[model samples]
Target: MNESAFQAGAARVDITPPLGTLINGDFITHYARFIHDPLYAKALVLQQGKTTLALVIVDICAMPKDLLDEVKIALQNETGLLPQQVLIASTHTHAAGSVASLLLGAADLPYRQKLPALLIESVKAALQHRRPAKIGFGAVDVPEHVVCRRFFMKEGYQALNPVTGGLDGVKTNPFGDEQQIDRRVAPVDPQVSFLAVKGLDDQWISVLANYSLHYVGDWENGTITADYFGVFSEEIGRLLQAGPGFVGMMSNGTSGEANIWDFLDPDRYPKAHFAKSELIGKDIAGKVANALQAIGWQEAPELSARYTEVAAGVRKPSAEELDAAKKLAAESQYETIQQVDRDALRRIYAREQVLLNDYPDTNLFPVQALQIGTGRIGALGAEFFAETGLKLKQNHQPYFTITMANGYIGYVPPAHEIERGGYETWRCRTSFLEPGAEEAIRTQLVELLKAEAERPVYSSYEIKQYER
Candidate 1:
């Protein structure tokens, strides 16, 4: 091994605390029911010479962009790493801390202030413990456990055409109309891709697993936990030959409408479903370990990593639209919808329109591309639907992994889903990004991929060059 190759160190900090109350879109509060002991916020640090990159994955519910910005700023100031170099991703756990902005009807300021500090500490500890390591990439398909929760149905409750068939005339757009859809057309992609890094002594240091399946697991009691990602991380740690220090970070993929529990089917809801968070965690971890064994160890050097920000147009609500939303929210049967509408009404009545600026139509979407040897890891800003993810993988050849919903800009449904005018689409009271948002994202990713593919290969020097 070269004496001066890149090194990696990982550390996980338990942030599941004295219970910061949790809430989901359903507006029902729930406490953390520990299916497994202890939830965590994990950090993995990679250093190539002086260029250091730190990735922190939190098992919290959706991470607000502002909070993430704060964490990034603190990391940059503390460790001299650029904001882009310090990638912070949430597991989208509905059972974890309450950090989402209040406009979406979820706001807990006390916990939100403390979260960034906790995350920063986790990253600092990981960077402090950096050591020489080897990284390998592998993936496995495990689609059976996950399914798309949103579906299209006619007014009479008959199945509508699927959007995957090029969106010609799908009757319902799941993203646009929040109220009418009764069933989903298909399940989301459930492939779990991972990057395994181990120390020179063969101790597993960090395992970054990316999967597309929203976590709506047994979450009904306002408890602070890591949801399925935490369970998966714990399982991976137990399976690792290394000590408890083995860090596993599960980054959610394109799962805007996908979840372990089928919301439309009450049988699959949290209380009735047989697929526990622990089981989901264990299954993915085992599959990752299995893939690791078959592939063995390979030295992967950081070829190139770049970050870009695109202005994603948000759908703005007009005075009439706001009035209509307030009316619907006041009369809606769902408490969650009512709460959001009531809040919006209060703001409108108080002339507190400035608050809406924070929730504007155009959002700064961050897209990050990291090339490890020949593999690529793409991070998107929004909760992209599965079709967008699959398209990115298909167009970008040799894409080792593509993770969406990293920043969680609500949901980016396919054009057809947008036209179906369902909850995800209608809830956006901001800019109407053309139906081609998915295509635009894919195009940008392809551009990045082409650049990375043209870059020189670095692994050839680490091992005897072998052609695949």
Candidate 2:
């Protein structure tokens, strides 16, 4: 392969915060206790022809929409690339410091302050590391790691939101009574895809992977971990015996409603959180290795990026609705944390809605499409549901989405999910994007990928042979 035809570079920058930085996984505040593994902002730059594409995956909870836009604009100015050409996404690791300036946690100012500079530096480093490389794209179905957390419940036993006490659309878990769960609220995309770039020396440069399972809660509270995001890279590299300077990243997919919870078997086997994360980490790495064996590596392909912004209005509650929510919040009791935390967060956002209505508010949703030869990607600024992702893949071949991309707008569930009523669509501050946002996102993504792509042709036998 003539590596000069495909130039790829990868770099990583350490971004772990001070030990005391507040962690943002739960309702109660948590501070970084012990950093088991360092967090990083990993970058990969690909250039084919004159077009260039940049991807930065930061290990954190989320990056606010406005902040992400600001970063992209600055990066474009410095690097002389169109703002749309650079895409930054978060790993959505709950145990890491927060960049999501809303909801249950406040942005860790110290970390947030240095984030933009360090991220841009990572990209520049990658550009400096650029070398002729051979790239391959492959997907492996790892269904066992993912489970649909949201469940439609039995008629009489519908759970209630803490604030509204209104019917909870679906039970996330059946609370040990698995029989009460009627069915999964949505479908899951078990396909975990990777883009592997290797230098002319046949050494690994970078491996960019995506999966839909939410952050593994095993590393919650005291420990600051990247969850399984970094583990995927470390394990895969070790298994493949990658050379030095290798970078691996597992970005968050549309997993707002997807998790590792085995709801069907309520009484789960007892295991420590890190142990669980390790179990999942190794399993996923193995899948990546298996898929890599079958990938048809290609050289010299087209590169292009399409970015579009959609104006989605915020879903605001009426004056009367706000007043009712405040009253319920006041009367609500702090019962079990599961119930109490839900009620408290809902109530807090309910008040936010009242205060926000004093002024006009509209959210700018950014959708990005990246084309790297046979690899196609959809990057979104919101925590998208699994069904929405499945829908996108159904429409476009060889495409997957990276969530918390550029920015995060909480959870974006499907239309039916919004109607079903859950924490994700309960008219809260976190999930305030107005309805039809899903359609807008889907409509634009379809337009970008509908064009003739640089997909590699494989024989019929190769296609069927890869589907073990």
Candidate 3:
């Protein structure tokens, strides 16, 4: 292994939990009884001129910052890769085993305990199989698959805010009701960006794709599947005719306010168990496979990573709100999160208020940037809006965002969206972040990316122009 030679390796380890493990990503808890498809922790490692970077993509809904921090430390001690050099992200699949408590879904203790060792194994295996390789970046617009989940309803329709008991201007997931929707609130990022890695002999080593459609959650609760994320990975590998050693990873992009549902065209989008997910995944894979033919491969491009933490205030409940929530909880007599009525939004959100009141006044959220060849991968610890991601790309081309990476700080809706007061801005445990959190995260991340790519820092005026 020559120190100057660019090399890469890829590996995956099964992370599918046993039946009866809790599956999360919903307002209520679901236990996995049947495994629709196996979940995995996939790792891709790249090295050039003594610089090494490892990216790990897991097929889970989300992992807590503390859990991933501990995993990074173990990886550091074992593989000597610093925490900054290791970029770990969740695919944001709603049907996988729960590792982080969200809404009413508590962490599956048995399944959570197995993740650390398995994640470590995936990376170590990739390290052991490094081979001389080349890399290229490719992107294709696939707009038809992603749609804005949030919408501005018709003027007469009342969009109620569950937390504040007021009318919101915007509504989320207003499924199958186009008559009430005035228009979509946002635009979907159509770009399906990917990084293709191959051995010097042109055999595929790995392909990592990023898209802004959060997840295609067509599966029923209690089914353990990776939604479309796993489908895309497998489909891409098969499309490329890659060997068994080849790996394919699809990371979640800025999709806090987007999904795969088209409400206006209701008849066109009917929910089948896994039919829609498989179709969307393979279609996106086909797009990537076709685009790969034109990529200009780079045998040795620079690899660098930058990581920082920015403090953001938690959207804690006011004293009056907390008092009201306490009264509601006492009246409901719910002993546990699961015991709370899933259909009762007021009761469910009251529990969230009580829990969020205990959160620290401020939290240090992680922001990271990784540069490989001419592509820059930005990582944030929250489910950010599509607008935030698009703003970052304005400052630099060939850039994509990885959300819920390193940790989960809940949803980082833009200040304007917060004013609209939809489900994503309803100030619950799942959406508890300050209004300005989005701007703060994006500003810091853009600076980090500029430094990593050796580009000049944007002036205040330039940033303002970009934001405009």
Best by lDDT: 3
Model 3 stretches astray by more than 4 angstroms: 333-343, 452-468
Which residue runs of candidate 1 sit more than 4 Å off their true CA positions?
1-3, 20-25, 28-37, 102-104, 158-183, 262-275, 326-361, 397-406, 429-434, 452-468
What clash pairs does model 3 have? Answer: none
Rate residue 230 of model 3 by lDDT.
Answer: 94
Cα RMSD to the true fold for all candidates? 7.9, 7.4, 5.1
Candidate 2: Cα lDDT at 214: 90
User: Tens-digit lDDT track for model 1 on 1-468?
Assistant: 353587888987777645535454433344334434456778988776656677777876667666676677667677777665666777877666566642344556677777778888898889777888888777899986788766655565433221111222233234344456655665578788888889888888988888888774564454555777877787787777658778878888887767765444445433533247767788888888788886556554754666655665655446764564456455534433343343443332222223342465656666676666657777776677788778777855335333433355566677777776544453432214557676676677667666744332222311231121
Supply the global lDDT for candidate 1.
0.63
- Weakest 10 consecutive residues, lDDT, candidate 2? 459-468
- CA shift of 342, model 3, Å: 9.5
Looking at model 1, residue 145 earns an lDDT score of 72
Best of the candidates, TM-score:
3
Q: Count the backbone clashes (under 3 Å) in each candidate.
A: 35, 1, 0
What is the C-alpha lDDT profile of model 3 across 1-468, one tens digit per residue?
A: 787999999999999999899988887788998899999999999998767899999999999988898888888788788777788999999888999998778899888899999999999999988999999988899998888989998878887776888889898888545788889998878889889999999999999999999888887778999888999999999999999999999999999999887887765655678988998999999999999999999998898887778888899889999999988877764434454332377887888999999999887788889999888899998898889988988987788888899898679999999999888899987788788988988999988988844432333432443233
For candidate 2, the per-residue lDDT at 184 reads 86
Sorted on TM-score, best first, the list reads: 3, 2, 1
